[model samples]
Target: MIKRKWSILFLLGLSFASVCQAGGDIDALYSRIAQKDIQALNELKALAKDNNAQALAELGFIYEYGVSVSVDIPQAIKYYEQACDLDGDYGCFNAAYFYEYGIGTQKDITQAKTLAKQLREKINLSNINLDKKVSER
Candidate 1:
């Protein structure tokens, strides 16, 4: 029984460590972005492979605004859509804006409205979670 308990605790600790490591990687990626390090682009691409929403959203921004690369509106829209599907609220808003204005996509007010609503809900939920954390502290 003691061995089983120890094994369960070890597995839990391993999972927590992995989660922390992923968070650290994300933080490092943001730090690289702040420095405009070209290596950050590669890191972002790698993270996107795991469907990291922040990485996808950042990639969309980079492509959309021609940050250190040629402007590619279609590519930006694709990344934004992927990020939005992953529940990245900023990406959802960007995708919705593109759909609404027919920028890099066909004008679809209905789709834009749907995405806008989803983004709003996500923001609300995030705020609530933040509030809970603050209160707990």
Candidate 2:
């Protein structure tokens, strides 16, 4: 039990360190996106094509808000759908919101409700797992 606890802690610490190291790159990408840099957008698009959920979500936001491309709710929704299919929670949330409000797609309260429930369950499960881990320690 002690060895398992230490192993978990080590893995968590390593993951956290990697996240911290990637923060700078993520910030740079966001900055480029905010500036509407075409090169950065192209790179993101390529990444999205490779099934990068974060890239897809960012592209969805760009299209939704007309940051660089003209505002196209349908396109945004499509990107969000792709991201959600890749298990991106933010994408799922945005897609659900759009469905609920009929922003881009037809109003589908049932679908939205289902998605929201799924998201809730996923979050709950994640929390439960974290709690169990903590308790084990």
Best by TM-score: 2
lDDT of 2: 0.76
- Model 2 Cα lDDT, one tens digit per residue, 32-83: 9789788877877887898977778888998999987799999998898788
In candidate 2, residue 119 scores what lDDT?
58
lDDT of each: 0.80, 0.76
How much is 66 displaced in model 2, in angstroms?
0.9
For 19-114, candidate 1 gives per-residue lDDT tens digits of: 788768877776676567888878888998889887888889888988776789989988988888998988988987887778888877777777
Q: Least accurate stretch of 10 residues (summed lDDT) in model 1?
A: 128-137
Off by over 4 Å in 1: 1-38, 125-137
Measured by lDDT, the strongest candidate is 1
